[model samples]
Target: MSAAYVEHRPISSSKDTLTDHHVVIVNGASVGGEFSTQLAAKNYACKEGYHPVHVARERHLQNRDIPDHWRKDPC
Candidate 1:
């Protein structure tokens, strides 16, 4: 696959992450993966390249330590 470009507005702090209040969530999917879904499921917004499968996995990883509602649940 060709290189994929992800874009986002300037983030000022970790508070901007969709996964955690302490993490920095950047919008955009992996060139061949699912970083976007992982971020979006937690209410994170991205500009492009969103894969549901990938996002679901990211949500799972992000939720390993938090309560059910505290993290993104698998769809």
Candidate 2:
């Protein structure tokens, strides 16, 4: 059965604030999937054929910059 997983985390940071919050959604074998927002990721996770949707939040020190293209809406 197909499964959906969502991970929410921060991708970039400054001395004062955390930025570039990201939500990633994976359906089955695809690990590189990303969503613009948490709601969008949740919606995709709840779609038909995706079983046992899992949602998680992670906190970590920002490690890398987000690409400019990743900031655009995918829809």
Candidate 3:
């Protein structure tokens, strides 16, 4: 697969915790993974009041600083 890119933007900030804010990813379709997995993570994070970010498969693979488990739950 080619390189993928992911972007994270926080729509709002919370006085309590980072997860208390709202976030969204504009280019979710280009992410190259199972839409369900991405959606599931997105829904799950939002439900928990956490920020949700999206990246292309390429970017995700290139990001060595991000932990493996974080890919599963990015909040």
Query: For this target, which candidate reaches the highest TM-score against the unseen true structure?
Result: 2
Higher-lDDT candidate of 1 and 2 = 2
Among the numbered candidates, top lDDT falls to 2
| Clash pairs for candidate 2 | none
lDDT of 2 by residue, 10-50 (tens): 44344444534445444434343566666667666565445
> Between prediction 2 and prediction 3, which has the larger TM-score?
2
lDDT per residue for candidate 3 within 19-55, as digits (tens), equals 3222233333423223334455466444545444433
lDDT of 1 by residue, 1-75 (tens): 112222222223354454322222333332333333334423332233222222223232332234342422232
TM-score of 3: 0.27
Q: After superposition, how far is residue 37 of candidate 1 from its true place, in Å?
A: 15
Give Cα distance to truth, residue 51, candidate 3, Å.
Answer: 2.3
Clashing pairs in 3: 3-58, 4-56, 4-57, 4-58, 4-59, 5-55, 5-56, 6-55, 6-56, 19-49
Q: lDDT scores for all predictions?
A: 0.30, 0.47, 0.36
The ten-residue window of minimal lDDT in model 3 covers 1-10
Task: After the best TM-score superposition of candidate 2, give how far the Cα of residue 37 lies from its true spot, in angstroms.
Answer: 1.4
Ten contiguous residues with the weakest lDDT in model 2: 66-75
Q: Count the backbone clashes (under 3 Å) in each candidate.
A: 3, 0, 10
**Arranged by TM-score, best first:** 2, 3, 1
| TM-score for candidate 1, residues paired by index | 0.16
